[model samples]
Target: MGPVPWTVNSEIYPEAYRGLCGGMSATVNWISNLIVAQSFLSIAEATGAGPAFMILVGVAVVAFIFVAVFVPETKGLSFEEVERIWQERPQRNRGVAAVPDQKEPLL
Candidate 1:
């Protein structure tokens, strides 16, 4: 959690748009935090803590599934390599670690 967003933001964007994307990502992250913090107590009060937490858990599960399906494995890849992967791979193949005919170890 601590490093994941920063790492993904850095690796996912092209050099020309990295700053813009990073700023947007940070803005979204902070806004999301604000929303949850502001709503948690009210949600808990309306539906006990257990149900409130379960709602959060449900959201987290959906987020996990989205990432698993959409985010590419960027480990050991350079900025150019990462950009190339996104450009060359189809949407369905984006999440795969091993690209066809590529020797690069992507984990």
Candidate 2:
């Protein structure tokens, strides 16, 4: 959960979109870190470090569920392979319409 959002965004895009997506993701990650660094001390002061971290733990749980449901296991998958994997899900379920399944391995 820790840094999962920070790390994963840059990894999931297709090869064609990776440059654009990676840049955007890096910006978002750094901005989020800036905001948290600036705000966390105040938040902790207003509501103790223990409670603040507990809230983050709850957020981590939610993030875990999100990843489990929405993120595919892309390990050992090429960018095209990962794209095909995600495109396997029904449009009704989420995201773009299912592309026709390829018979050849997605290298």
Candidate 3:
């Protein structure tokens, strides 16, 4: 669920920025997971496990709402269609090429 936006963004953003954005998104996700894990014991102790769990649930709800309102349906759309839509934006034109030879080949 969370990876959807990052995947779309990575596909539509400039090639040069894709890796950075993906890495940042991944790092933030991991960090958030770690924080939640590390904080769970303290949160459960201070505020009760119920409240801590509710907080996590609330975050998920908020994320769902945001996606529902802002994210478009990508279902059934081919990759080319997706790229065509993204290419409409001037800034994204370079990033939305039909063939993305963005990443360097491994030597």
Top lDDT hit:
1
Candidate maximizing TM-score: 1
For residues 39-82, write the lDDT of model 2, one tens digit per residue.
Answer: 88998999999998887778679878998988888777676777
- State residue 79's C-alpha deviation in candidate 1, in Å: 1.1
lDDT of 3: 0.72
lDDT of 1 by residue, 1-107 (tens): 33556878979888888899999888878887898999999999999999999999998888888888888999899899999887777665656757565688767
Check candidate 2 and list the clashing pairs: none
Whole-model alpha-carbon lDDT for candidate 1: 0.84
| Deviating ranges (above 4 Å) for candidate 2 | 1-11, 90-107
Tell me the TM-score of each prediction against the true structure: 0.79, 0.69, 0.61
lDDT of 3 by residue, 1-107 (tens): 45765666645545657778778777887787788889889988999989988988998899889878755566777656666665665466557777666488757
lDDT for 3 in candidate 2 is: 72
Better of 1 and 3 by TM-score: 1
Instruction: Identify the runs in model 1 with alpha carbons over 4 angstroms from their true place.
Output: 1-3, 90-107
User: Clashes per prediction?
Assistant: 0, 0, 0
